[model samples]
Target chain A: MTTASAEPLLSLRNVEVVYDNVSLAVSGVSLDVPEGQLIALLGANGAGKSTTLRSISGLLQAARGKVTRGEIRYAGQLVNTLSPQDRVKLGIVQVLEGRHVFEQLTTNENLEAACPVEMSRAEMRSALDRAYTFFPRLAERRNATSGYLSGGEQQMLAIARALMTRPRMLMLDEPSLGLSPMLTTEIFSIIRRINREEGISVLLVEQNAFAALDLVSHGYLIESGRVVMHDTATAMKNNPDIQEFYLGGHGVNFRDIKHYRRRKRWLT
Target chain B: MDWILFLELAANGAVTGLLYAMVAISIVLIFKSSAVPNLAQGALVMVGAYAVLAFSDWLGLPMWLAIPAAMVFMFGLGIGIERHALRRLAGQPIIMILMMTLGLDIFLRGITLAAFGGSARRMDLGISDDPLFVGQILMSRVHLTGAAVALMVFAALVLFFRTRRGIRLRAISNDYVASWSVGIGVEQGVALSWALAAVISTIAGVFWGAVQGVDQSLSLLLLKSLTVAVLGGLDSLPGAIVAGILLGVLESVVSGYLDPLVGGGSRELVVAVTLILTVLIRPHGLFGDRSVERI
Candidate 1:
């Protein structure tokens, strides 16, 4: 993270997204994930975190969403206009907010499905081995139908499937959403290893602020469609506003922060 | 009881059942890949038969050349339709897309009627009209050949899903956005699915036309396949085949024996009752996935 390169791996400058032509989802949210860095994007529900990840991966367009403004750069190239498939080929893959693993497909088949059709058999075999190595639990149930997997296992399969794509930068939304506390800790440890051992850059979006802060060194906090805070995870954790508001702090100023309502619709 | 006649009718039922399932499989293929209900499937079959007629009966090409040419033509037509018409309508409501295909069905049926006229057309696949017998029962070569083809297609489909391309198709079917996130060309997958569905329909057309003779009624046969699709599960390939053959056998046996006592054409009733029973028993279809993902 402290490599201090002139350009970050991914940089979003004043980005704005709107869905269904009229509903303003988010605006002016900007951050950068440096090479080999684990960066967290923290926000509550409807805080536009998932929309930002989807926008970066071009899934917004697929869902009738458009990035009407701002620059999204991935691997130092402007990528707001790219298709989701093309963005993936350029080494950015998003594990969508929910565990969107193909439920009908078997777990092993799902991994193979994520691979490009052009992948060689040997290469695919190794990719499967790598994924299985990352989550031994997934390896145990490799042939089971994904619909039958437990919530935590389904989340693991989703990330393992994304990993099978061999992405350079992995963006995960709500990795700990429905997982048990122990399972969440276990999953985050593997994520850390994936980032550290494999050197894959991570951009994690989560509603679980404490868990996200524990893993990522740098963080961006957006509330109501705009970036309200950006700092190192340490700074974010110690900040009084984030502590009193997000870190389960007591309710002396709860009513006042609720009215911090900056309805900054950026795409207009 | 005239048990020999009953056995022969049962054999005929099996053949007809496979053909009916063939059309259902085509429906399932398109529906599974893109969630687009291809209401034009039967019309596609009719058009395919007409193409074979144009190539063989009109142009005097042999069966060898005529069949492949018609299939390739249908494949291109399918991809072309997807590219020009359905591609732009991506993310539209399912009902809207389904209606568009219904429109396509009428349009294609009208075109076939204009192009080939309302007269019946026959295709000589050279499979011969001779009846093959086992023990006391007799089976037509045409039905057996068509059934064999259907079985082979089923096998090929299983093998296809096991291959990387097939797995990707399944992935796309399972989750379109998720598939795209992992580097799949969703548009291309949808188009390819249409093309495959077209090819299957054309083969069914060729076989059905060979038996029933290509005419306006060939397109209406989609009603039967639709019945099979719903009875089997629109998204289940194996379910389609099983339902197709089951309905076919039921129709054959009932019309053969029960119809004489009941005074004609209760096969439709039997199919309706069976479909109702299937719905009551397994609403998701015999082999369909239990529930699609909500999110």
Candidate 2:
């Protein structure tokens, strides 16, 4: 498949994130989310996947992390210095990892809380209506406190709340974490529908390689805070190394595959 | 054992409790938004009362204008404290924030002493202190007016929380990071909490000043307010109100009946004992939400 000719909606050029002014968390990574495209960032644990997402969303500052050496451009404008709230106002919203909904707030209030400060009462109501339509399960439990909702329902609320901002691009961190297989499949399909129907670009970070690669049009494999492989979804799925290590293919013995060889294959 | 005196003391205690509720609600608001217990709350209250005194007595403003003017000044002061002092220390351990508040309490007290001198001044809002008969029992008009005002403020707070803006503030209290992700300004929310707390503290200070005179001892109300907060659970608004009334009535009855028998000044003892009993028996307070563990 050919890449879109227009400039990407969000682009990170050689981004380097440093934590506490000492430790490097994300090093020299570059990626893009073309307009209206679904992209997945696949990585192992502590591979800086969440850090990259946080950097883009301007949430790294809260964690004592900074994008020290790269430009994070959203819609052709530099946004490295923008506050997270400002980023959301500029149409960038992130669904934080672990489905962090306002547990004490009712489901409807959770969405209402996400509406922009300048939004009119009529606009807020319609935005809430749009969110509920996307997640009907949340609508059914609108008045219930979010903490009492099931895991799947909380994830839905998190996404729907993000949607209340009417974001041009939605970045989700591990939407499938700790969810049942059936629920994960159902959520991924809904995400695909949102991308297609709402025309919102998505930058997804996930560990479920099989499901992620199947859903995204393009995928980037990250390791040790750097991108090791970038390819179309079909190409990455067929790569032997990704198949052996990430996709759980062939059930190869751990001792049989040499670590150096695996590293060299991806590096080359 | 005069029934008339007993009824009068109880009625007065209930009104005092309403004032305590206002101050405790301020503490709870700061705690909810920022997880800081605001050791400086009493100082804020004292300063608020002194601000009113400065406006009305020193500047010769009318009581009507002075009260609102003082509230606006205190509101700005609250935001300034949060923005200039506390916001700079974000990402530090909460204990550090608590220590900062402790230090702020001393700093504010010093400033008040240097500026106002250590003298008690009466604040007359023109509300009559004359006792009026409610059936057989007598009630102070000052206390009655204070209670009515406190209840109205409580109603306003309840309605505020139901608005979209208030929901945003509530969302910040729930999770700062989550609130930020959804476009909420966490720092602004915290600052607004401080501003609101300051306004409430000013109102509490005015009532306390009207009754007891505006002295440095006005800051001692913080101790009673803290006890009320602890009894109601530090984060619960309704709990603070109930606890405030309960402590108020308890103090009045104990001091009224037992003071003559044990000399004077048993009211402070009631607060001390109630605080201890609450800690030992119900550490979560009466209305606090208990953390539930899901297996």
Candidate 3:
């Protein structure tokens, strides 16, 4: 992380975090993300990838787990003292894991929920129209309740809702977790477009290594709550260790076998 | 024993039942939104009655002016309770929050007693206190008006929830994490829910005071209303209204006819029996959802 040439848009310096005393979720992890760059965080199951994002979002109190180490700076401000809501107001938004759409609310209502009142009616309408243009499926079901939407439509609605906030940097967790291959590719293209055209920085966390590597320019590989490798996406894609542990040998099909097992275990 | 006497009592019971339903609706609104059955709700009703009496009778203000003013004061009180107390203890156990509200009930009651003094004052609505006779049954003009107001409020609330704001509130109540990630102002929605509940409570207080006379004893009626809500379903507003009316009719019947053999206060006994049976039959209440745990 000590490249030392370009200023990072968001940087985590020597962060240490522990959860429940027995489980050390993250320790001595440092990450540097530049402005308008799409970076992927690749990790196996239980490798502290989710914990890192949670800390960044201020949803999980790092103080509770003894930061014991370093500071997180965003756009030249020390954000460790700010609450989750304050972080949101400061243009940092996280699209949480699982399509966390307000299921009882309509698609349009859900879109309007995250919208700050700062935008004028015309501006809001344009932004809303842009979202509808991006996902016409959501537009078709604009007044429909979220629970009734198909899983893919719900995911689209979730992303659309987050975009309504007009975030400077969007952090997405498992965007393609359970989607079909075609849907996964569609979402990846949108992520790439957001970074390239919209100039919105993306901090994407995904276990779909093949897709993530194709999408992100640079990335860091984490294991057991520590960073084990860091390089360009091309280098990480070629790494044997990542392929064997996370990518299921070929790294082509990321249908999430472990998730299937986990769900099965719960049912049994 | 006459049919005319039975009909008269039934009409009176219907009016009183409607007032109880309005109060029960308030309890359901707060309970559904915050998942905290506000014990202080009864105290809020007593405070509302006292506010109306002080403004209209003591301060010599017109009833029209005092009504909205009393509701505003109660709304402020509700917001204050949420900001100073409930918000801080957001994730605490339900029992712990309920206990805190119970303590709040005592604190509010003590304050009201200290301020208003310990005497029953007949609150004049400045309307005709005369009862209208229909057959052998007589109903007060105030009671009839109270019924109308209660009906209108419930209708309005039903429509409000179907609107955008109401949908947002219900979404938050159903799942807060989903609501928050969608950028909903969940904390604000929760506060607004409490404020709305307080406004309804204030209206209920005014009507109850008109029928029973405003005093410290007004708080006792809250218990009966609470019992009705619990039986009807604490989460269902319509259930609360239906249960309130049903209980009112049942009590009136017992007192009017069966009391001769069972002795007076038999109505209370019947409510107690019904409460026990309801708990056994449907612990979640008649309209409440069965508990569904997420994996």
Q: Give per-residue CA lDDT, model 1, range A24-105, as digits (tens).
A: 8898888999988999999889999999999998889877899999999987789999888888888899998788989989
- Candidate 2 on B216-280: residue-level lDDT in tens? 88888888999999898888898988888889888998899999999998999999999899889
Q: Write the per-residue lDDT of candidate 1 for residues B111-164, one digit (tens) a residue.
A: 988988899877678888987887878888888899999999888998998988
**lDDT score for residue A228 of model 1:** 80
DockQ of each: 0.82, 0.88, 0.33
Ordered by TM-score, highest first, the candidates read 2, 1, 3
Top-scoring candidate (TM-score): 2
- Global lDDT scores for all candidate models: 0.87, 0.91, 0.79
Error of 3 at B155 (Å): 3.7
Q: What is the Cα-based lDDT of residue A47 in candidate 1?
A: 90
Q: What is the TM-score of chain A alone in each candidate?
A: 0.93, 0.95, 0.86
On lDDT, the stronger of 1 and 2 is: 2
Write down the TM-score of every candidate: 0.94, 0.95, 0.86
In model 2, which regions exceed 4 Å deviation? A1-5, A256-268, B1-7, B291-295
Q: Which residue segments of model 3 deviate by more than 4 Å?
A: A1-6, A18-24, A61-69, A119-121, A250-268, B1-14, B133-138, B158-167, B246-257, B291-295
Candidate with top lDDT is: 2
- Name the docking class for model 1: high
